[model samples]
Target: MYKVFFRICRYPHVVIGLVNITTGEKGYWWFSILHEEMLCEEYHVKNLKGVLLDELPQNGGWFDYNDINRI
Candidate 1:
């Protein structure tokens, strides 16, 4: 299983980036917050670099798990 990390954007309902914890692969494409919410509820996507959904940082580029603590 891969842990997912994300950063929020200026838009309140969008995610700007996604990072795969183990592989360090990043997805720069934007994602809908609603979709991710569904993913969390249905698929049990729990790991967001140990941060809560409402606590994700905003206005930054893609980042990996290592950057979570620094952010």
Candidate 2:
């Protein structure tokens, strides 16, 4: 079990990204503006390294994916 934290653009806080290496599953929590709370969503990826290198596109805007910290 591995957890990675990322700070996406426009959001003031960090989002928690979860990874299960054994199952090759990934997830993360984000603040849903409409719902006004945090929500979790699953991502299909091999590992954290893949997520950083391939899965998330580095767009220079509010949707930009930026790695902050991890645990």
Candidate 3:
């Protein structure tokens, strides 16, 4: 068995929830999830609670090779 940890964020820098899994591989960051979902708005990306931005409405897209596309 392995220990695994997971976290959910309303936005990139915003961390909302975290959990531990009883079994899993060594901990690793999942930076590839951006493309997996068409949009992160469901997770409150637009209205991220804990995340703060230099500008209001924070009209920025998820990180990526380009880091410009909203989805």
Candidate 4:
């Protein structure tokens, strides 16, 4: 599984959630107080960049593609 970055319509650096992608399944993980997770489809997601969850900042912001490659 991997963490997929997503930017809202107006906020470019903020990560609204993550997409957990596996062999043939994907799920959405909304990072919030409620901490929700749901199964979703690839097309249902947009503006995504694959990144390892461990490399992400706790505050949630932009991550360099190079960092992803290093993992």
Candidate 5:
């Protein structure tokens, strides 16, 4: 299973950060909250929580590929 960290952006937009606990791989993506459940299902992410905006990198996208690698 994967552990996902997320933060709500403007309106329906959500920034999602994922860590593959077993492989130590990480990634980030964004989508509407309306599809959050679907994302969890597809990713097999059973654990998820909200994070402070400050916890993320200061990038144009709120986060970047390199930031996720550090997470």
Candidate 6:
């Protein structure tokens, strides 16, 4: 039951760098890098550092991946 929350310092999307902000694990760091690069070329307002998607909202909303693709 892992959950992620964002401080939302000054950005819309939270950027979870290579390091897992919670457990400090290693993986999906590329996601952060890619996001930064995107912001640079697209938004040009890179200042993201929030919660990762896989680590966010444990079904807090109406949709949860746990069963989405399972049918």
Clashing pairs in 2: none
Q: Using lDDT as the measure, name the better of candidate 1 and candidate 3.
A: 1
lDDT of 6: 0.34
- RMSD of each predicted structure: 8.9, 10.4, 12.5, 12.7, 9.7, 11.5
Clashes of each: 0, 0, 0, 0, 0, 2
Given candidate 2, what's the lDDT at residue 65?
31
lDDT of each: 0.45, 0.37, 0.30, 0.37, 0.51, 0.34
Task: Give the better candidate number (1 or 6) by TM-score.
Answer: 1
User: 3 or 6: which has the higher lDDT?
Assistant: 6
Off by over 4 Å in 2: 3-12, 30-71
Q: Candidate 2: minimum summed lDDT over ten consecutive residues — where?
A: 32-41
- Top TM-score hit: 5
TM-score of 6: 0.22
Candidate 6 off by > 4 Å: 1-17, 28-36, 41-71
**Model 5 segments more than 4 A misplaced:** 37-47, 50-71
Q: Model 2 compared with the native: what TM-score?
A: 0.28
Give the best candidate by lDDT: 5
Residue pairs clashing, model 5: none
Ranking by TM-score: 5, 1, 2, 4, 6, 3
User: Tens digits of per-residue lDDT for model 2 on 2-47?
Assistant: 4444434235543445455556566654432322121222344422
lDDT, residue 55, candidate 4: 31
List the candidate 3 regions with Cα displacement exceeding 4 Å: 1-5, 13-24, 38-71
**lDDT at 36, model 5:** 56
The candidate, 3 or 6, that scores higher on TM-score is 6
